[model samples]
Target: MGISRHATAHWEGDLKTGKGRLSTPDSGLMQDTRYAFSSRFGDEKGTNPEELIAAAHAGCFTMALSAKLAEAGHPPARLDTRADVDLSMEDGPALSRIRLKLDAEVPGIDEARFQEIANDAKENCPVSKALSAVPITLEAKLKR
Candidate 1:
């Protein structure tokens, strides 16, 4: 004998004007900050999912980098990170690539070690892992 998990999907069309104008912020770069550069992910301002993903990725990477730096005895003064998620329409609107631009200020850290730590954070960050390919489980139930 086995138990079954259940879930439901819901959606309503014709909800809005569908006038979601995309905002491609002319990205400069990144590496650390807080109440400093002011990453405005709040309110969304009617942004798309791609933008949200980018914001989350950026924040996650920054935090990860901070932890890495501190662990390595070189706590960062600040970190500014920008993650650019590219949405491609060439093949039915898909996420093609993600670019992370980071500008970091760490005391008593060399370029080589900093790069290593940054790469480590990029590879090990929670968000980065989530963005990677993974298996999914699902359950569905019907409404009567």
Candidate 2:
């Protein structure tokens, strides 16, 4: 069977004034973390769905890149990835695009080869595959 993970959201009251708590029991990384309309759409301090998605995408992409590099015999010394999830209300509130910015330090790998690997990871990563409906862009930099 394929791997499965789960998180739960507990919301109270109406949308505008309601508050919610998100919890990931398995990892315990998020325990009753607060999220609300203000935190999502306004300047309130809390977690939001887009931010969570970005975090997941960034983490997945980074690990995928590492794997790709290792498979290519150019294991990375370090890799940093940032995913930006854009949420817009065109027809409705939808995830319009995702941008992945990756900075990698690999010994003996050229820029062209690094770019190729980064592109491959961006296209083949699990998270990228899962979010295939959204437009995904990548900016990769190889550092010496």
Candidate 3:
């Protein structure tokens, strides 16, 4: 379980009135980074850490679900997962909640069984384990 990402930031002033750029490893895009309470809440085009976390969670959950399906002998023909992370200022820089949606096309599984597998995937996914402080909701659909 080894993964790495790097970002460099430069700030000239205090947190409320400062701005920075966040970039991934080898990414060419200079994303705008600032305090959420500033004038950059949902207006700036750049992404924040919560969005990145959501992306990772989505990918991780999809892979976990795929593995679960295959392990159950009903491998999915296709699986699409999307995760939405909401950020709030209750305590600190923490994820308020996460919503996950999964659409899959697999053979030889009923909706109930598919849902069971999806629940298992959600509980066992790595990202989910890492984000145990946040509540996650799942909506799974089986394509007929």
Candidate 4:
């Protein structure tokens, strides 16, 4: 069986001064948002593509890292991951770079083994696979 999720965004007015709201149809959480050419072009409110990408990256990397740790027989005591996605307007809303920082506490794991798993998770995470056109950089700290 497969599961599906959905989100919807509603926009009104012009691009430079338009506003909208985004909601998770399944969860019923609606967030007020606004987008402008100034924000996209001039720097202004609302949400942008980079923010969405970051959300996806953060969730995907965490799951991937957890799987890696479990597969390696270490099983993380704690894992914290963050991803920062960069978007350059010159080339549309494409991922330019992803900054992934991970902090993991895994018992009985050596540095080499930890690094290998972290690197593999960074490179092979579902979001990473989907955004193969972009470059991803990883910074991981592992502790016993």
**Model 1 Cα lDDT, one tens digit per residue, 1-144:** 885433222223332422322333334222111111112223324444666678888898889989998999988887888788876768676777788888776778877788888888888898888987522111111111
Question: What local lDDT score does residue 54 receive in model 4, on the 0 to 100 scale?
Answer: 86
Q: How do the predictions measure up, each by TM-score? A: 0.64, 0.97, 0.80, 0.84
lDDT of each: 0.63, 0.94, 0.82, 0.80
Name the best candidate (by lDDT): 2
lDDT of 4 at 89: 60
lDDT of 1 at 78: 76
Expressed as tens digits, the lDDT of each residue in 1-144 for candidate 3 is 898756765556666655666555366544545433253355655556777788889999999999999999999999999999987867876668999998899999999999999999998899999998899999999999
2 or 3, which is superior by TM-score?
A: 2
Candidate 1 RMSD to the correct structure:
15.7
> What overall lDDT, based on C-alpha atoms, would model 3 receive against the true structure?
0.82
Which residue pairs does candidate 3 place in steric collision? none
Error of 1 at 41 (Å): 18
How displaced is residue 45 in candidate 4, in Å? Answer: 5.3
Q: RMSD of model 3, in Å? A: 3.0
**What TM-score does candidate 3 reach?**
0.80
Candidate 1: what lDDT?
A: 0.63
For model 2, the superposed segments whose C-alpha errors exceed 4 Å read none
Best by TM-score: 2
RMSD of each: 15.7, 0.8, 3.0, 2.3
